[model samples]
Target: MTTSFLPQSPPAAEVRTAAGGHRTTVLIGTDTYPPDVNGAAYFTARLARGLVRRGVRVHVVCASPDGRPHTAERDGVVEHRLRSVPSLVHDSVRLALPVGVRGHLDRIMERLRPDTVHIQNHFLVGRMLAAAARARGVPVVATNHFMPENLFDYVHVPGPLRPHAARLAWRDLGAVLSRVDHVTTPTPAAARLLWEQGFARPVEPVSCGIDLARFRPVEGGDAQRGRIRARLGIPDRTTVVFVGRLDEEKRADELIRAVARTGADVQLVLAGHGAYRGRLEELAAAEGVADRVVFLGFVSHEDLPDVYRSADLFAIAGIAELQSIATLEAMASGLPVVAADAMALPHLVEEGGNGFLYRPGSARELAARVDEVVADGARRRAMGARSREMARAHRLEDSLARFERIYREVAAEGAAVPAGGFTAGR
Candidate 1:
């Protein structure tokens, strides 16, 4: 487990730079940001806001939501949105063209004079920003929130060729990450995955963490739950809620199938939107559980906690999670989990303890597991308590403190390094 650190006092009013400037700034680069509605974007936004709360000046460079350049301050962090085009594969995704990306990044680097550059992926925006930062002697810290499986649907990689595609993806990831000052993922299992993928550097696991204060067991909010359910158009029933993008890799269809197999008085509620929504709704109808499956598309972050509190339990069938922030949020809300036995999920679940894990693609197995937890009220409450206890270890404050430490260390080191010292290599 990653050790939790108490947050230090906010930094001094100002810090002197090598050029004798009086400010401490961090520039974060991501291919996506708010209104993008994905895990990486959510994490990056939270990270930026958290740093701002700790008295650090934060600037984010990311793709514009509407194909036009703009700058705005939100949640106490400055967002530098670059001109972008809609992705060919996804309706909601936008990608910045690489043709003149470096020039734009260079201008931003020169303007912000960021003390450190923290990148959230190895995609176009992050890769270009890292190069520009390195060229200017700004230390770059990268956090990996990627798995090739997550993109296979969008990229339309054939099933048989997925293995080769994954290999190429990992190699390309490693090449970019190798040039950075530090690398981190959200769990120890994810760190191991980087090593196995041939990334020749020490990787640290940092829990994306959650706001424990806000999401807690709503001990007796039956009225509140009903109100939330009514708002979401979810029928009042024993509900198994899954909160995430209804993406192909998430396998929400499995949840629909499993709910049908249970043949019980339960509904599966999905609270996000994606390309898979139409197909999933069709599958629910085909499985004869269309009425029992509710799609609460794109629930805002503010309402997400109530969404969790409205559930009887939380379930996920995704196979590519590094550390599922949604799962953590559900756990913090005191809901027991039913998850797929793959990736970093095992790190969060204790079989038959706080939750149960079933075979990744077996709807029958998943049905049985979900039934086992929901049938016995006493066991369910006990498991929910355990889930809450487990969630305490991943408080968002601890994550913020740990990241601040890393930023300070890397920034101090960056001050001494010569410009253009970092070069991409395996």
Candidate 2:
């Protein structure tokens, strides 16, 4: 039996109630958070920190980085981490046991009384929290960061049973999310995907924007690049970088094969960690490009901009990205992208304009596209410039402002309702 370190209530400064004044408080619920490297985790952390910067009180409920329950504060946002267990699927992943979770969540909601509850996914944490918030008459805003394909390999689901599993997952998501006040996804394509999967509801598309100011082109030139390269232990060669989880749906094996097929003095740098790392390393050796591939596992948030600066081009073979945040960061860093022509990648990669998109899972096609840009210096620079220009549309400030508006709108509507989100006082 695990001891409960769950706090009855946070410090006064951490959460302010309506009696204290009219400060908008948002409770963000997610199954993952920082120290758990993934797009959803990174986006949720950024959203919380961004809201705090905008003078809104923020609270995040997520699984503990370890198996212990605790409360901690960072970036002016309070984090309520619940007890979790090691996942049988992946080493870096953890599963929160839902048994007796609602009691803790109810205590949290009663103390915080958040104006709006923002759920990042319809998983264990998100689903339960949304239900708890709803029972207390709080408005809930849910974002879909889920893809069945992304989890198939992690859960060891059989190939033949994947379609059936996917349908069940989508139905479960719809049933949970439909109870929320609003639903959003990272891209229009993602929203359409939900609709196609039998979810009949209004789904808005919101870009998981990037911090353009932080991830701009390197100004220190070769000196800075050389320093970053040396620090990362990367060889001085024409580099193609990929940043994200090296997971199954990431299709990093295709990249290894593509690197081998390039048949040039080029290197592929994969700057993230996942369960698929071992397989990727093995694939690189099998393709005879072991020496040409560099694995920089779990790049720090502070050093990631420089990692982008160290590359000539960015490549993503990921087939299930709702909106690839790493791809946006690379574009913001003025690097031409070579992405697989799948999912929402086309939204970011404008073929022959900002970058090129090759047939997904085709190493020869990906190799050709990468070579086309690397071989032509003038074209490469032009594409990089276009990438930067295109990235400006998905600014972090804009996304934050949009979400703030949604929170205010929903909170206002919730206020007009009676206690328990019912009709009127009985």
Best by lDDT: 1
lDDT of 2 by residue, 1-426 (tens): 111111122234643233346668899999887666678888888888877776789999988878899999986789998999987766766777787789999999999989899999888999999889978889999999999998898888998999889878877887787788888999999998887776766789998888887889877866777777988788878899988777788888998999999855789999887777899999988888999999988665567788899998999998898999889999999999999898999999888998999999899999999999999888988999999999999998799889988998898887222221111111
Q: lDDT score, residue 308, model 2?
A: 90
For model 1, residues 1-426, the per-residue Cα lDDT tens digits are: 111112222334422232234446889999988667678888888888777776678899999999888999876679899889998867767998777789989999998888899999899999999989989989999999999988898889999999989888887887788788988899999998887776667889999988897788865657777877887677888899998888798999899999999956889998888878899999999999999998887665467788898998999999999999889999999999999999999999988889999999999999998899989989998999999999999998899879888988898876332222222342
TM-score of each: 0.91, 0.91
Q: How many clashes in each structure?
A: 0, 0
Model 2 worst lDDT window (10 residues): 1-10
Residue 208 accuracy (lDDT) in model 2: 86
Candidate 2 residues lying further than 4 Å off, grouped into runs, are 1-21, 220-224, 415-426
Compute the lDDT for candidate 2. Answer: 0.84
**How accurate locally is residue 251 in candidate 2, as Cα lDDT from 0 to 100?**
89
The Cα local distance difference test for each model comes to 0.84, 0.84
